[model samples]
Target chain A: MKSLKIFLLAGILVASCTNDPVEEQDSWPVDFDALVALNCRAIELRKARFATADSLRLDMDSIKASMNQSDFEKYQNDFETRKNALLSESNALADTIRLRMKGVMSDLGPDRKRVFNDSLQATLKREGCE
Target chain B: MKRILTLAIAALIISGCAKDDEPTVQETPTKSAAAKTYDADFMIDYFSLQCDIVRNTNGFLPTIAARGYGYLGVTAYESVVHGIPNGQSLAGQIQGMSAGSLPLPSADLKYDWALVSNKAMADMMRYMFGVNLNPDDAILIDNMEANTKAQLSAGVDADVIARSEQFGADLADAIYQVSKTDGGDESYLNPWQTPWEVPEADYCWIPTDLQLQPLSPDWMNNRSFIANIAEDTQIGAHIPYSSDPQSEFYAAAMEVYNQVNNNTPEQVTITEYWADDPFQTCTPTGHTFNILKQLLAESGATLEKTAVAFGMMGVAENDAFISCWKSKYDYMLIRPVSYIQEHIDPDFTTVIGTPPFPAFISGHSAEIGAGIKVMIDLFADAQGNYTFTDISQQQYGFTPRNFDNFYDLANECALSRFYGGIHFTMDNDKGLELGIAVGDAVVNELTWPKNIQ
Candidate 1:
């Protein structure tokens, strides 16, 4: 009975020791790639939103050329309100992405985190998201 | 015979549980007493984490960010100064800092300087950002400190690790006490300084955005690291505020108007790249620090060299903002958008949104000008040339920009503000001048280590 107990304990230790690498290999890449994709999507969304804001600004400028001072001021107030809302929404989205990235990255050790960041930057650049 | 079999089974269990990658506790021969023997990975990691924290934290605008960088750099240098050959403490050199301002490590004891720096940085970050630090950022900081200690603690004596950590924490506490008197403590709590009385004189700055009031109007009152640094490097008088179409002031406004209206795509790209907007990119100071980090990494700088460089740049950045802010509110010059819209073309709009502040001197220009000077001193040759591609903005979705020389890079940064139509020529030019002066003082006036081994 004692011999069996020793054999069981040794088996458990060996199994525990060998399980980590397999778990890491299975999960790390999938999670890292998902994070990279999420970040890229965030960047694209920010770009599109900003582009929309820029177009709106141009429209306001064109409209301003023909309007009287009082009318333009009123138009300007409304335009600012809309522009601010769009920017705020975009900013909030970026903040959320940052928080998510941090959460994903926190699980990694420093060296692994560096690798993940380097990969993310490369992926973003290759995809022309940067 | 049965007892021997039981002992053999125990050994098998222990051997199976041992990690193959775990380092043995034997002392490493290469880890000498010299600070330069160690790589700068620990400092680099901490500063990289700082960039994210600065970006995420609320109200860490350029001026406030510069202050945090100043204390961080000073703390880092102090944490490891004892290990550097011929290294001098920044205490007596910088203003309001006396000699023996920080705890000293015992001469007889060995220490891991990187571990010391790790602990100091961890403490400083918590103190610098205080309650504003995000929970996510706090986790990153804790992880970085733990990972660094784990890596550095291997092969080091337990006594040395404990002593080094205590000294680092003590150094941070002492530096924090010093920082409390710098007129910027808790400035982040009230960044806008609401209820400010805007000057009503002609050409005085007007609010371009309703959301932002004049930022840190009394930031000029913040104590500089170098005594009289701001007062001595004051910018000359700007062109007299004139509304006439042909006057120099009018010409400056026209120049901004023309540049924005006719800006090439490349110019617009430059404008956006250097925007260094808060909440998106960490402020301008963060951008400059990132460049320093990149350059140090490329150069493979030692822990000692990295600490000194960060300290010098930090002082220059902090003083540059104070000096620039002083000139800013002193002149209270109108931004180009306001000037062009009111005087040149009623429908004029800038390519970028104007920052809400007095615009005599471009804060971006002044801070970058100061930073580039320090980089040139450290990294450049006789002609101030250091070729490198800046990928610091890549994380912000901007493409990397290349520079063949530091001077051109500084010039481009200053010019980007002009191209953005937020700053006039005078603002960029004088801001650069002021920044260079501050940078020169940090390089020449402070007594850094003459020989870093």
Candidate 2:
């Protein structure tokens, strides 16, 4: 996979602010990080939380008609843990994206690089891109 | 002789310099006036610039403009109110007005909540997911007319940007005005009302001849798209750079839902009692769903087709509901209630009187408008060439405006909220624009491999 990427990179201009309108049209096809890593992390976090919610639903309905304070607290803690985990990972992913955009802009000396980096970072963070 | 010549030349030069020294302040005196701050005296005198700006009867231009402008509004608002998860709004005044509850504008029609809520939602959506409807994947262009930002983003003139902003704000104003008087106590622009028995020709504003035509074609078979939208929109409305899980979507959705639903009956004097609820009346047609079914039947369509249309409409509506709410919460501006309740009018309790949410824009009106737009578009697109002029009319307390097309349908949808006495003028205006924008996104983006589109 690494070798294939290198070969691909040789033919492609990764950060080129191309003047050719046709070539620039959906040219990259994918922002690789968004497609692979960020997407994967986000889904993993969601699936994990959804699974937790299903478990809690079952417990609240059937198992835990009555629960001790400690048990309730433990449940709350678990929920928070998952939430924080996702939030942290998402933030990290967003930072990574910001870094990448900054890297691209710096390479191209593009104006409004910071604006793009910041907005894109916030957008990713808001989406919880883990 | 030389001294005399030098002195004469010096005098000429000084005179020329004096003539040119006039201040460089006015850049087209009228243009400068248009750019003046309307909120200078804490009273905004928003001048309406209703030029015949090119808008498609249906397509990407207005949709992109709506989304892009909303992003701009929310971002600006958020910048103003930093740190807090949410900000303030203006729905309170509209709420009072809609209820016929507030003494007319003269007694002191404080802040307009309608405008604030609409702006808030627009801003939040952009903050969450700077949407990418133009398939070529960039912010700078409308989807149908993608300029491929690589070539165009740099070359975009400043005037185009200004025009787009004006277009959005203008659309908001028009929507707001439509809702204000449509069936409510104040509606003036829209003389015709909705969910009615027959059309009042004088009630509609759009020319008589224009009302003779039917809705678009593509919406007929695919009308069922509304019911399955959020799930389907996961395909079409998904931003190109968006990551998975969409935590922001969920978070914002939850917040918006909570904000709207959390309102206790105690807050607003209205919505506590149904206008003609089934329980209160012996009529089976009192149910909203039943009435809708009846309306569908009147169209002379089969039950299956009607059901399909409603379902698609349902999806469109739900997606819009989710979209608007999410957008609002993400941007989270204080409601007009905050401004009026604190600063302008102490007696004023907005329809959702408690004023829990900050307002900048109207999420409620926007979602309602979008849902109606989607349904109307779907219905019209399917049943092409049959104009709806003078068919259905209602005289709700807020408006009496007659509607004709999907655009008209969207206007009424937002108006109903205002008539119901929940949103302010701005809220209704912005919401309708947002709704149509969302509907447009769904129409353009959601596809099923040519077998569908």
Candidate 3:
């Protein structure tokens, strides 16, 4: 009787281990509203970052407009270096949000995924985050 | 008897666990009797991957990306041309390609065209994006090829698989050879022709970037795939240069100045949506290709239809850029930002960074115009109306924009440049005209398969 119980327990353990995590997660209800909120926050952050960069660029342009060719060239090189670094950071942020959204929507059927994406976009637009 | 029962129970438990550990095999579709029966999922997925690669690759600017797409599209079409009934190969149609240039598959052998397309696309992508392709993207290409092949090869004869892959690889090689002769080959190494003599004219383009050089100044000299398409599609002339406040040229400058000054939030959004800066986005050409991929997936297009669409659009994109560049250098018109600051408003600043190139014809305007025209022809009705949501920018954290017609989207893309204060209205208008002419030529000139419905 002891041996039988042990065998049964092993079988159950193996069976549980074999279960597909993706399918199991698919069965769980998704919090789509939370995802929309997350996406909105990301969009707002990106917009703010771009605004700051644009403002800085405008300032740099004003400063360079009055400089001689030599000074202008030096300043432009420094400005480009800074701009590239900021762009990389901005791209990294966007890539993270995209991956997260894709992960959440992975289990959804095509129709549902489209509907969810559309709804999220609508919300963003309505809230003026985009 | 008790020991026997115990052993039987143990065996049963082991068997049950073994069953759980067994892999679940997916059911393969019935062996396709003909190549036309294969769905376009493989082609669509490959093109989607190409878009990602284009976006991530270091030096795939618009001109280089357009040339890559042109070759990729031809490879795709040729890989499956034999499967489409009445389909004509592009060997004779495109420039520098002769009849019987590509190796043909056995007439009597059964070839899976999807496998052919899969292998060809994989090879061409590696070749076209050589050196610039990161390890992560290369892994993606490998995984996609393996997964697609596994699905396509099931229930098919091994001989057919071998033949298909060989033909695909050979086709890609042949196309690559053809691509090498195009003047733009390996042009990515020196995108900005440094130390180039800026034409000393009052109206010629001046550098606006740190590099102090124009982007792809020699790109206009690249060979166009379509014969005479570049020459035929060139813009007539730009608005004459004048610093006088009352001149049309100065008015054009002031228009850009005022637009940037009073740009609404919505206008700014539009500008950002279509900005498509290289190294950030996939540039203008890649954005257009992304839209095509989305539409193809939505409609459940077959490999045949998808290949033809890619082929046509790719040619259109390559030629459009060439023609646009020709006009750009020929006229060497000054960008709006330079003119506005010097003549109209010294304090003027554009909403977006001005690209370091001539601005006579907006590259975005011309490329998107050509792309949309191909899309409209392939997917639109007789009245030229097709409704679709463009989510191409969604991956970049931008909200999806909806369009009722392809023309509306093209026009919006053109207008975005103006609103951003980088292009004059005439630049956009003439750019559209040039693009539409090229698009029309691709549609009318190419002898694609009829009765695709």
Q: What is the C-alpha RMSD of each candidate to the true structure, in Å?
A: 17.9, 26.2, 18.4
Ranking by DockQ: 3, 1, 2
Q: Write the per-residue lDDT of candidate 3 for residues B1-453, one digit (tens) a residue.
A: 999999999999988876322322211223334445778868876776777788777777778888888888888888877877767788777787766677776665677888889999999999999887889999999999999999989988898899889989999999999989989877766777555787878898987655477888888888898887778888788888999988988888888888888999889889888986423667788889888987776676777788888888889999999999988888888999888878767777787888888998889999988888889889997555887677677766577787777899999999999999989999999999999898988888878776563
Q: Which ten-residue region of model 3 chain B has the weakest summed lDDT?
A: B20-29
Q: Using TM-score as the measure, name the better of candidate 1 and candidate 2.
A: 1
Reference contacts recovered by each candidate, as fractions?
0.02, 0.00, 0.26
lDDT tens digits by residue: candidate 1, B120-190: 99999999999898888889888989999999999999988998899789889999998999899978888
Candidate 3 ranges with C-alpha deviation above 4 Å? A1-31, A34-38, A48-56, A59-118, A125-128, B1-35, B277-279
Superior candidate under lDDT, 2 versus 3:
3
How much DockQ does model 3 earn?
0.16
Where does model 2 exceed 4 Å of error?
A1-130, B1-292, B350-360, B381-402, B415-424, B447-453
lDDT, candidate 1, A1-130, per-residue tens: 9999999999999998886232232455346555566667656654654565565545754676779999888976776676556555545555455455445444554445455555566666667666
After TM-score superposition, the amount by which residue B431's alpha carbon in candidate 3 deviates from its true location, in angstroms, is 0.3
What is the interface root-mean-square deviation of candidate 2? 22.7
